[model samples]
Target: MSNKVIKEPSNQLEYIISSKQEHEYSKAVNKLFDLALTYIEDAEKGNRLGRKAAWTQGVFEAPLFYACDTVPISAIDLGRLSSRNSVQIAEEAFDLPKETCSMISVLLGEWVLRNNSSVKRVVAFNNACEPFNMAYELIREQGYDVFRVEGAIRPKLNHDGRLDQVIKFLSGELGDLAVWLTGKQLDESRMAREIARMNRILAKVRTVMELRLKNSLYIKSLPTMFILMGSGHYFGKPDEFEAVLDELIDELNSSDVIPSPLGKVIPLTWIGARGLEFGVYKAVDDCGGALLSWFTPNPYDRNWREDVPPLESMARYILDYFLVGSPVHQIKGIERMIEQSSSKGIFFYHYVGCAFGGVHVEIFRDYFKKRGIPSIGLDGCFQVGAPSGQLLTRVRAFIEMFS
Candidate 1:
């Protein structure tokens, strides 16, 4: 995990884009990964000791990743690299249960095997779900400095001083981490700059989300998702990410009827984690449908009110992130997406071994059923290997039901 160049990613796309010559997006994604790795390398080499944050924060934003020089690596990314044997490597090394091992377990194993030396600190948040809780404990047992944070989730929707409470809790936890890691207080200027960069990234993300509905764009939703989400570890160089996004918007604006997989162009809403499967998005389009909304975790998922304090603004962003709280919030998010996109159907993605997602699928399915919206469930992890003849057939059938 040092600045020492490791083996190339087994996945061809990761390989293609990791190359400097492929595309702006390829370069941007690789740049983000490299930047995060550089920090880890620095930490490993004692250049910046104790500045690393292991994100047991689940899908919520880790402000320190960009706001400061600390390295922030998501546990989800640490587990599932495109290599077929990455999980096995984790399983053997961590003595993880073979039968019921979830992605998070495998991911912790991967991080343990690959990044144990560089990871000096671990940050866990409440309400990320059970598997994440278990993973957090495992990290602590492994002897890294661990910090637990409270997330914004109240029993009653709107209570007195809820916002204030959330802000206080958020600041307390992150602020303490900042002090512990860097021995400095939160940098207002640095946080503001990072917020500004994130705002721009989010704006582009919204545009891409909207443009996915446009049949004439002819671009796949996967790249847009990847660019917006940035391999789930860090979003490096907003300008570079924006460059690729601008190219896409230009292409979409210039085109009238670009070729696409969406046969009859029936728009659908994707309700699940992001980056689980690019193939499913393509499959939906290929089966005469358009995936207008893929509800993965977005840090800047909402409008950043200039009226609010930067720290509070960042807190609110994480509070409202799609994956932060309960399934009620997720259901509301799906309902809003459906209304906004005017989607004809919903596709619930369940990663094969993720109980959190699996449990929520039934809830989503039931909700959609009550709404009289036809929804289908698909299974996969974070790769293109999700789509199969059976899955494609199910997608086609689902689209046909609407047609």
Candidate 2:
């Protein structure tokens, strides 16, 4: 056997550390990093304090694991932090194609290298993409206890209680997943508590998003994305995460606004997958542009219903996600975000391997162009590196148009 190992990337922590020293929300950012480090270390050790640690396929499925007493660490989040070497290891080990989604490849690479051996269980869904489903199968073949949830695709034309039926089916599936994880029936009370806790964090995130629109200089683009995405699993510490959000909110609310380092801020809305490179956001910042909002299906943008049955409510939350609807619905969502953020342009970036997002770039670009709004689509892999010359040029040109 070839002796090789995939070590967890420290670049993410490095970025967070640098940001804490330079950014406005130092206290909260530091806390967030500490919490994330604790969780990652615990996960690598095979549990969170005492609960089972499971790799979760998507953010939406995290709450189910939380309620079922499992710590749901996001596999995609891990992939986002992966270094190029780690990705290569995954591709070679799994015989993954060059066209395989980078996120899936990175996670599989980490698993195959036994970098995250403590996470012996995987909670995956079928709704994300084909490669993700394939990853689930591969994980099972690797001797993992994998639980797959059947994701419901929202009907484009809802008629005759079709939406309700989808909700019911998905709820049942989630219920089954909950029981499978814990060998006990789904606990509605615990589910409600978890949902409530997440809702609090989401509400705070919404406030920060609003603040970003009003005070675009208060935070940077990459950190905004990080904060919003953290709502997915709360870095495996809900209480600490909440406190971090509170601290960040207070800082943003009280801090005096400062002029952009590059004068004349051009507000923009990012509409696709977040590139793993920090330079992607730095390029925008260098161009005197601020990404005020992102048009994506973020759980932080909405709340789960605490008044309803927890499983059914979770199902509704999934169905109600902006991405679950038709293209028209997604377009409308983008329009609302642009209007709210007063964005002068749209930055649509997608990984070359993300077929689902890549195909829609032109559709959205054309739709927004007709309305006289400028937009640009960039395609690249989610690898940790500096932005390409062409990428920087396009970003500079796009922002210069507004300038």
Q: Could you tell me the lDDT of residue 277 within candidate 2?
A: 61
Per-residue accuracy of model 2 over 55-132 as CA lDDT, tens digit each: 884467666778887777777677665666877887777888887887777778877876444667787777777887
lDDT per prediction? Answer: 0.59, 0.75
Which residue runs of candidate 1 sit more than 4 Å off their true CA positions?
1-63, 80-82, 99-101, 116-120, 143-145, 160-163, 231-234, 261-263, 299-301, 330-332, 382-389
Taking all chains together, each candidate's TM-score versus the true structure is 0.78, 0.91
lDDT of 2 at 291: 92
The residue-by-residue lDDT of candidate 1 on 67-114, one tens digit each, is 666545555544334355656665675677764444664566555765
Stretches of candidate 2 exceeding 4 Å from the true structure:
1-14, 46-49
